[model samples]
Target: METSVLLIEPDPTAAQEITEILQEGGFLPVTRQSFEAVHDSVTDEMPPKAILIGTDNVKESVLSFISELKADPSTQWIPLFILSRTNEDSFRIDCFNAGADEFFLKPIHPKELLARLRGWVNRIGNFEESAFRDPLTKAYNRRYFDLHILLELQKAQKNDYPISVAFIDADKFKSINDNYGHHVGDLVLQGLSKILREKTRTSDLVARYGGEEFVILFPKASGDQAANRIQTILEYVRENPVAEYEGQLRHITFSCGVAEWKPGLSVTEWVKLADDGVYEAKGQGRNRVILSNLQTSEHDHLEEKKKVLIVAGKGMSKSIVCEIDSLAYEIQEWQQGIEEVPPEICIYVIPPTKGFDAGEYEQFRMKHLPKECKTLLLTENHKALDSFQIMATGIDGYLRGPYLPGDIELGLRRLTNLN
Candidate 1:
């Protein structure tokens, strides 16, 4: 069980030497040619546990890249190490500020480097151990799931994708332990784990949250998509008995509550939303898949055509305008001099434009936008909105520019609660 580490180094000689050192340390080192290539590994079945940036060209752009990674929830937790040729105190401080967990000067001591990495990785969790899994079910443990959902949420936010959670609780699970004995209960849990692993996509995560409780993570999936998959699993569980208790076949059924990640929801809030659905499912008579009720109350406007007011200035891309127009929404455009907002407008698409300022935008929002209307801002990545800006301007969320139609769709979904 070797720990996998990523080395992003453009210099072949440096990369090979580092690779040798990593191999000697009993770790697996994967070398990529560029920073962009590192992101390609994010989709890998097993992403590297840590990342090492070894390069001579540690410029401002590199610092910015480090900041981006640290800003991202998913990649931020990975132990990031920067190997630099210069040992200037100011530059070293800059590296640390940009989110490098450890900074080392080049012409490195191999043993020292390996020791530091090992110590850091061990503190995070030795992937070699069963710390990440449940002993009984062999599914990921609650601790692992808790850490994983945060990363998935961050990844989903950065990539403009949806992530969903399903809280599955075994129905009448106490009865199994009470009547059939705990061994049969453990067998039933194992059977459920097997079915979950077999039924889900390899990318999806299945974890035993606790006794008779499990949670599944579905990245790039909407609530409905998660519900459909859970429904299939529910059907399978109902039709096939999990274990035999004495002479009787012990059938099992589970109720699942599914919730999709929303723009501003916290990890606890999101999980609670899904758990609420599970409660609702049990209330409605167990063994069913239920989507969270939060959407039902928040998205009441869905009963009518979603109304959108497009404020695409001259700088706004024509493609973006077309994309918004293509959505199944009642579309209205803001007239150049018009200050009055139309009634029942659910959202406002405000793209970047020259001569526009945040102060003016705030004033416009106050004067024209309805209190319930959610706003999505479009801007370049370099000028991406910060928390202060988002709060000051009263914007719900933003989409980085040079975005595709799919990106627009996802951004809209985030702001408008669209499926």
Candidate 2:
């Protein structure tokens, strides 16, 4: 399929030159002589997938034009590239700061320009295939839910955080489709999706799970806590009616089943537990939320209470002990100056101290560390070490500062799947 590009060049000669190259490259290129006329010329039916702005001058008006394009809600999300003859540092910086996905110098190499432009358009198309939204309801689809569920599981395992999942099904939905047309059924779904989006916390994720069902992931919430929130949604659905069909207002209620995520639990198992909860909710009645009765066996508790050793200088080691003590693990303290590492400890924490060197620690670890173990290091700051230096050491992770949350946590979670 030919990708459409909106090319804006103040100079007619340059616009005509680029237009021919785009046509030869099999792109449907629309040329405009003025940036001010861009929005008006491109109507909703024929909106370009991306826009390219080219000019030799780097004036405030040029920068303002980019800013104005960004400010206009219709043009904001569309990819925009800036092409100019001026390659000054300030000019490039201002263009990107305003909003330019790609910047190129003038005297365009037609092949290079087309390759780069097509690359961005193709990438956006691939991403849209795996896009988060469910077209019918405007909620996230199961793709987004599955991706986040696994991520949240890894985080819960690493950081000892609580997470919950709920499976929600609209009661007697097929009857609604049978009585009223599928059109009304779609409206019912859209209405329910809006209610779920508005009612849930921003931290929570709600997704459409095929027909008549939806799923939600509640990070940092237990099953009971998830149940509490679902109760309110249940009440709201009861109070509200969906659509007016045949002079009668149609109403719908949902049944929800909630389960908490646990350490050592696989994503499939976690989802199964939630599905089981839905089964119970359906068995009990159609319009209720039920929390699954799950017991943490002695084996599970023992796993959660796994021992973690901290190896560092006295000051830093003790500080790490304090931080990790907040978690479920049993803390074992070891002075970094010690000759040997304890064999039994599988997980280790090494918080930063002044004058510590990662290069030297790489050598020390080879000699004394156990063959199979997890090591988490804390550097001076975010920029204390480059990613290659951090990665070269082959540690499991870096510690997140108590104040600056999420950076290390998210980075480490991503690193786990690289294997």
Candidate 3:
């Protein structure tokens, strides 16, 4: 199907000419005269792929309409272009500030306008696809899983519909990288990804979160149903070879953690719980599935014993030490530039500019931080939060700079309760 374009222009002659030009250029153009008509049309029908507003001589009404469209979620994703009569420098800044995707001069050439419109249409389609797909697996990724699973979780909370998540990790994956080349390991990963895509339903999401780990979001699936699915996949992989490298078959096994979505739990909380279940499976011995809930009090009790380490910088380290000490919990503190003492909770209070190396910190978090331990990163820099979030190396909570002793206590308490 051809892309749709909404052309908003008050001049009848200009609108007719543009409509003819767009149709000839292989687009389906819809013309409207006023902001109210465009608003009504978008509300009653699907939004156009892009909106072209003629700001020929900046009118307050037209500017207001553009602002309104940009603010509305329903129309925010639509690419917007402005046709201006003013000089490029003067209007270019204002047009972009007003959320225009592209700006064109008045007496627009039919060919140039069509080319720009087609370019934007292609860009938007690519953006939408990238937003929901895993970069590595080419499967529906976490963004889609979060949106769709949250909706299902809400329904489960209201109507008692069962929903669960399974966290899967390749057993002894690091050894594979150590024994075979990383290239061979990557081939195994790709083969496993293909098998997962073939086995799962279109409704399910299989996201490759990071190295050797994946999450499956299952809506309307009970704990038993989730475990059964994961078990089937495990058995299939064990029996079927993924890759033949170095004259030997590469077989893969996975450890799975299953947790049913609970009422009044946020999406983040549900994911954490499922991840904890995965840790439990790994602890019990790899290549198994573990489930947790109120009904499984033994599992819950075992989970509480998990430890966390809090690593703090020089300035905030003292504050964290003082706070945790007052709480009557014995915590070992590691000073800046010293070896981090292995603790259940590691608190880093280092300054933003002097953050730890990414690869080193991640190795510490994964190897030193206990399986149950969570890391609380307390820094004064917001940029550090973005960096750690992207790395996703088990830094659970972040506190900005100039924090009070109470803030440190609160962060520790939250992390403790989460564990």
**Models ranked on lDDT:** 1, 2, 3
Give the 10-residue window scoring lowest on summed lDDT in candidate 2: 401-410
Cα RMSD for predicted model 2: 14.4
lDDT of 1 by residue, 142-167 (tens): 87786566556656765788899999
Worst 10 residues of 1 by lDDT: 347-356
Cα lDDT tens digits, model 3, 293-402, are 63544444333322334455433444354344424244666544665545666675546456545677777666556676667776655665576453566567767854
Name the 10 consecutive residues with the lowest summed lDDT in model 3. 299-308
Tell me the RMSD of model 1 versus the true structure. 10.0
In candidate 1, list every pair of residues with a backbone clash.
Answer: none
User: Deviation in angstroms for 189 in model 1?
Assistant: 2.6
Error of 3 at 341 (Å): 40
Model 1 CA deviation exceeding 4 Å by range? 1-3, 16-45, 59-73, 81-132, 239-241, 244-249, 262-273, 292-297, 300-419
**Backbone clash total, candidate 2:** 0
**How far in Å is the alpha carbon of 245 misplaced in model 2?**
3.1
**All candidates: TM-score:** 0.56, 0.45, 0.48
lDDT of 3: 0.69
